[model samples]
Target: MMHGLAETTTGALTLEHIGRRFGETLALDDVSFSIRHGEIICLVGQSGCGKSSLLRIIAGVDTADSGRVLLGKTEVAGPDRFVEPEERNIGFVFQDYALFPHLTVEENVAFGLKKLPRHEARERAAAVIARIGIETLARRYPHMLSGGEQQRVALARALAPKPRILLMDEPFSNLDRGLRERVREETTATLRALGTTVIMVTHDPEEALSAGDRVVLMQKGRIVQIATGYEIYDRPNSLYAAEFFCPLNKLPGVYRNGRVETALGAFPAGLNLPEGGQALACIRPQAFRLAQPGEGMSARVVRCSFLGEIEQLAIKVEGVEGTLHMRTTERIEVKPGDDVRLVIEPGGVLAFPQA
Candidate 1:
């Protein structure tokens, strides 16, 4: 939980000890979590980490090998209980923005509301179209609309039934980067305005951190951590978790007292390692500050490339094991083989026991 972001006391969705396997590979192992009403939770991980498998189980498209899933008072999945996909009232927006080319935008939107009268369904679709600001696209077919328009139609169809919850599996992966950002903003605003409870699955860490109220990070079919973006990025539970978000420079040494010696010189790392105990100091690239030649830790620039507002560089320090990767916005007249210096901020270093 994060301050200023109050989760609903009422459990909107809950997964208890969920497990699934594909042949010899475990897809999900003992995964459990609770979601509050109107909350947006992102399930994020690397490829083949079982994020999609978990989403399928939650959507009722696939069955879990173990444990239970509940939405409000409805027992959606359990050892002895199972609910069909349609009956669960979960709206899924697929990665491809699955829309019907044969149907008009209005017809597509109305498809999910078939339980309502034909007239009532059209009315609901029209209202949702207006809400999506795509009323003008109501009569257009999927091919007649742009990528963003088609996505809006898909989203409109999903929301037409006023589902208990919405499940989006990388819904924005299809569009171009620019269009994706715009559509994401629009979709997020609409979901929040309608107070919809959403559980989305994506492999992109940036998307998970930017759009989720809480991020559920998965690794090898197991949840490593679940927290707000800030907490997960800054206070990772493990080295694996830390490296998942960004690259880290590892410095190996032995710890004695409270410091870990590294190529960059020793700084305080509160690890209580006995003398001669192994330790590894981890530092993020952005933590390095540029300094005048010989004024700070010495290094030789091996590579530099301008990246819009910042420059990406690879530098080699005398005692560091590998080339250090860093990104900085500071203007520096340096190229390959140029001597450079950098200083690590006080809190930039984190020491852990050598694995």
Candidate 2:
């Protein structure tokens, strides 16, 4: 579901009932989502999960076997209509940057302005280079520039065209962690300043959370959940979504009489579920707090690992089958084989159907 007032005030780019296939394998399966103008939407998923395929469809680089893509009110792709990539006026920043090695930065940036006179093309390219804060490297070749510099040059080229939309296909995948972080922040700021509509595909969760106005979690070519980072983390709709977003410790539980009974204790079941049915409940490490032996559920510390700021403990309850992972900020004094208690906060349990 779409969130916030921006989605309603501004019309969105819509993909309706999109489906694509490659022989016997399905790349996209009736996937649909909307991205509002001036909003940055991130498509995130595992490898071979149709994230890139969906981006290509939106860019008009590939046609869907069935479905419609609408930009504002215009139908860009559908059963009877298909817009060519060049006609779509969408800027694409590839993973590799794809700059011309032989050409200077200015020449490369001006490649898309072929229709304009040479003087006008150079003028526009110069303006964009200045806007991206890379005017000093106007005469340098791609190989002469650093990874971050080359990325900026590529962005300048894409922004030079003044496209109605910008599509980035894993743009930060090639850079190191430090460079990726800096470039992403700068690029996001640039896009925001221009109020550009952008769709970025990335496998990195941190990047998706930091760069996107909205995160669209995809799986098997279908949209799972579209929400802000906080919403997705706090209230994941399914087990798959929750586990994909972060590490989760799931335990067997039963929903009965409007309550969920687990190893920890019986708690009020907030979600609607059939009574007397077995379900899986998810608890994140941060959701639990350490308690005194008699204050909470009794358990024994099976293992502990120091993770810099926080300490992770693997605890085992006497009757519970699986180990429960817990994280604490303070250095825990407990050791392996030491009996401790785990207090499952009533608000942290997220239960789903067993199937």
Candidate 3:
């Protein structure tokens, strides 16, 4: 067992080489990470990417076939020792809220305080309800509350017991776009104010970027990259990781003389690339610019749409067969059949090895 002081200094949760298999499918493969006190981490990936499996293993809802889970220096899940979920003192907030229809907001928050004295439980429940800014809805049943209200009640209930760590499984997935954003901001602020450690699973890139202190991107039951939101967006390690976070315009070309020669034009490679090797270059829509007729690569406008803040244009190059979309702030004086020139900005190109 690890020493108590060392554990306190490191974190409250640790997973070492965790792996879980279900018949022919491998859910989690060699997963390892740690979460410290009063920190929030977000796990992000496509569906069936082992994020939920890792959370379940940590919560003790599912056992790992191989590996050890340590909560505060105590081996919660291992070959010889298995600690029950309740004994681990970890709270979980599910996607569906999971509020009991029969219970009021106040009663639901008080549910987990059963071990405490009656008066103390009531006082704690009241405190949490007020902290969540839902004291007015204390008497409302789950069925009567709106989606956002129920979400707050569920969170209040989970935090009422003051668990060492909190796990949220796509908690904002059910709400509408507007409500989801509001609830996310509110919940994140609440957690930070209380100095609560949290691990949340999400498929939405925006949610992962805005809500997490660090974002962990997973693929094929393995972590592909772990970094801050800005790092993940600006410096993606792999093509898959880049495509996962935003729309990538993949241009097929060859790298030569420290530059990528594509159908559009030759552009300097921002990062190192193998000389004279075939690669796929990634460019965001905002990276391209409209140029004069003869100055840049010739292309014909295919379509145009007006977004709120900017205009989206689809242009087809003479040499490049498919349509390429670009976003620009300035409104272009062009139509669907209008011919235009495409200029790729320097240092905007990201090249990866061609598969």
Local accuracy of candidate 2 as per-residue lDDT tens digits, 92-201: 99999999999999999999999889899999999999999998999999999998998999999998989998999999889999889988999999999999999999
* C-alpha RMSD for every candidate: 4.6, 4.3, 2.3
Instruction: Report the Cα lDDT for candidate 2.
Output: 0.86
Candidate 3, residues 48-162, lDDT tens digits: the string is: 9999999999999999999888886777888777889998889999999999899999999999999999999999999999999999999989999999998999999999999
TM-score versus the correct structure, for each prediction = 0.94, 0.92, 0.94
Instruction: Give lDDT for model 1.
Output: 0.86
Which residue window of length 10 is worst by lDDT in model 2?
Answer: 1-10
* Clash pairs (backbone) in predicted model 1: none
- Could you tell me which residue pairs clash in candidate 2? none
Model 1 C-alpha lDDT per residue in residues 230-270, reported as the tens digit of each score: 89888787788788887888889778768888778786776
Question: What is the lDDT for 28 in model 1?
Answer: 95
Task: Give the backbone clash total of model 2.
Answer: 0
- Tell me the deviation in Å of residue 258 in model 2: 2.4
